[model samples]
Target chain A: MTASTAGTRLAIDASDLVKTYKGGVQAVRGVNLRIPAGTVFGLLGPNGAGKSTLVRMLTTLSAPTGGSASVAGFDIVRQQKQVRRAIGCVAQNSGVDVQATGRENLLLQGRVYGMRGVELNRRADELLLRFGLAEVGNRFVKTYSGGMKRKLDVALGLMHSPQVLFLDEPTTGLDPEARSEMWEQIRELAWDQGLTILLTTHYLEEADQLARNLAIVDQGRIVVEGTPDELKAQLNGDAVSLELAAGSDADTAKSIALEQGGVLSEIGVDGLTLRGRSADGAGAVPALLAALEAADIHVASVTVARPSLDDVYMRYTGRSFNAAEQAAAHAAKEEKK
Target chain B: MSALADTWYMTGRAFRAFLRQPMYVAFTLIQPMIWLLLFGQLFKSVTQLPGFGASNYETYLVPSIVVMSGFFGAGWGGMAILDDLTRGVLDRFLVSPVNRASLILGRLIVQVLSIVIQAIIILLFGAAVGASYHHLVMGVLVLMVATNLLATAIGALSYGLALLVRREESIIAASNFVLMPLQFMSTGFMALVLMPHWMQDITKFNPVNWTLVAGRGALGADPDWGPIFENLGYLAVLMVLCAWVSTRAFRSYQRSM
Candidate 1:
């Protein structure tokens, strides 16, 4: 990480970044990230994983409790304004002022960056058109739909042509359609425009689909870091899912499947579904099916998958992502009281 | 240059939001008139007393109303900052290359502008009710500046309170607690000479009364620029002090984040 070089490849270079809130809640313990320029790096985690806290420190919204980090090679603490100038941050919470028109927000954001007159207007217009906000650009943001308001938030962040972009759960509250639309926009942003983007998302599908490289964050630390495919490949085998008949006993089905297994890792069973792992999945299925059939266990269907991000999470964290999220959510509620 | 530009742009953002609620503007201008018209008439004979200085009470009440209007109006300034803080807009601006001063200045600009406009209206309403000043227009001008200085000071303090507490009920309760006593303690509602000796001593230190004295002093036939400027200087000092306290609150905000 060359602080003086104008052409440093690491758009974001962080080391041992930590954030402990005043009440001693160590939201972010010790996390390090080095994302190359023009790559979409993702931080995937559940609630209370300190994803938001880390983003806050990196974006210069919060002071780090310890350690150091830099964006665009400028120290986050010392060169905050430079880091702020080099990066555009779209926080988990939408920062749009609902009272102001979409265009008005853009103009103000552009002006804050020292843009003026016609050039500013042209950039604002271009972003409005690009984000499909041109139709509702003159309307107050309160009137805009969730997707439109979110698009405007991105537009506000992009007004100054920042070198790096931080999108923290950018599609968190959008409906499926809007979420996919945002995905396409993010894809375009990464593929065509080539900006270094650091996105934090709890949605496995979101991280899998968009991020070129990602880190799995849990309990304030990076559990694993690699490309999505690399993480799933670490699972190394087939994820066999058995949809048992509606009336079939889940407990009985689990034991029957476990009986005829080699190199099988028991993944959990939910209601009428039983899932497990096998290195020789295609070959092992028939015998396993015959054994269940002999026991009068009626099988509805069986399918095999090449490990998902969830499976990778389960393997590393020793718990499913949803369970971790639920436990964290419960703890958060207790802490709030 | 960019820092000043950012502050100007921030003011524009707050002003746009201020305009969204026409009801706010209505209440801001009209509420003070209720005090001017009704309270001025109710105490119509107060000017007959020695040391009241004016020919009638309404004329005396006009400058006081201008002072009170800005005082109360500026007290709610924290609510807007709290709204922005909760809405994530404050973090948006904070993470940008925006001058930190812009956040305070942005809201202050709107507060001052609102008080200035409303102060002019209050002065005119006083005139309509037979409250004539010796130098009518110039007097109103001085009152506007004085009132705005007071408003900016209060607005900065409100913003500081918001950043510190980050709670609505706390800001509202704090505003009421601070404003109610300060409102009556000053010469805003009573002639200074008629006030209790102890209360008059408090008035000497009260920024609100300083604003009143400055505005009222300018309206007299023989305007004393010396005392008026002195009061303005007091208001300026108060503004700077409040601004310092408010900016210090930002450090707390940053650390808490």
Candidate 2:
């Protein structure tokens, strides 16, 4: 929580930020952050893990039930207006007006920040063009593809050119191409304009690819925080993942590998899959594969790779990443309905 | 920009969105006119009954119909707010430097505009039927102002309810629950004299009845300015009070989040 970030000018600084909602639901539990200016920081988590809640507090959309936070050096509680003016927020949910044209949404957003007439129109046109939405600027947003709508959401956030941009789950529902495009825009915003971006995403690749530093949030708390490379490097060895064909006995593979495959160690078998870490992945692969095949295990696919964010998540949370995600997805489904 | 300027801009957004959704606007405007026309025609002969206020049912119902149109139109104000809430448009504005008052005022203006449009059409339909306006400009002017004030109150209350409920179905159910009974209890359909004694007592406390009394007073050839101003004054105060409550409801919404 006290780790010093890289720069003197911290864009967002919070100490022990806590937001406990009604009925004893602690949505955010004492999270601290120091995000330097001109960089991207990611809050990576599954659904219902309080990433959005934390972002909401930082954006001044919801007051912290307990702790304090300041955005752009203005206290969020005492100086909400300044905090609001200093930050541009794009929530997990798309905020574009479906009935209005893309250009219209941007212009209104500009006026919301007190920008007027010529300046507002110029900013709107610039955002539309920069986001590749210039051609369809006049069309209703409802008709736009999911990716296009998402780009407009990001464009709308940048309309007023605030000091920091907060993006919550920016790539959640976007198609692959659109997600890549949004990534490009985000990268450009940080590198080109020297804008500070606080992005929240569940996608591991999103954090690894874009974030200068990231934190994994689960059950209303930050489990781990560091650069993606640093977090993955915390573990000492390469990650080994293998899936078995249907009806193959995972126990037979695990016992056979431990007994015969001397090179492979610390192996874990879960249902039809075996996951473990290896000191020497290249050296262990041949022995592990031979032992599993000799034991009549139908090895579906074997992968030896670098440690990923998901592995870091598993190491810290003691639960499979996808399992947490499936549960969060279910809760989110029930919530919206 | 000032909150007032922001409100103006926000109002433009709401107004444009209302116009853009042609189908929804068409239906909202049309439903009340059908009620006015049918109520006028179906109950044309009811005016002959004892203690009926006017020579024809249409003329007597015209002023009440104007209030009814405004009330009904204002009820849908919640739906508009709910659309923005569920769609995250409200959150976008909340997280920005946008004024909290502007968020409420902007939509209130749009809701009043929507109700007033319907009020004008209902008035014209009334004139087309048996209803007559000797001082057309004066009569329409009073009703327009009255409609704006009353609709503002109704719209504010609708927005408060929408914030409290946060569900579209609840808004619809709550609007119907509060509105249907209130409309029937007011002097919208029948003369107060024709109603049961108990119902008449309730009508005195009804905001809709207060509006009806004001509208009908202004509609007369020899209009009574004092009583009309009195009711309009009450409605203006109610508008202020309701707007305050609705604005405070934003706190409740944020608390829920």
Give me the candidate number with maximum lDDT: 1
Q: How far in Å is the alpha carbon of A226 misplaced in model 1?
A: 1.2
Best by TM-score: 1
DockQ of each: 0.86, 0.75
Q: Against the unseen true structure, what C-alpha lDDT does each candidate score?
A: 0.88, 0.85
| iRMSD of prediction 2 | 0.8
B155-201 in candidate 1: lDDT tens per residue?
A: 88998899999999998899889888987998876778899999999
- Candidate 1 local lDDT, residue B100: 87
Q: Docking category for candidate 1? A: high
DockQ result, candidate 2: 0.75
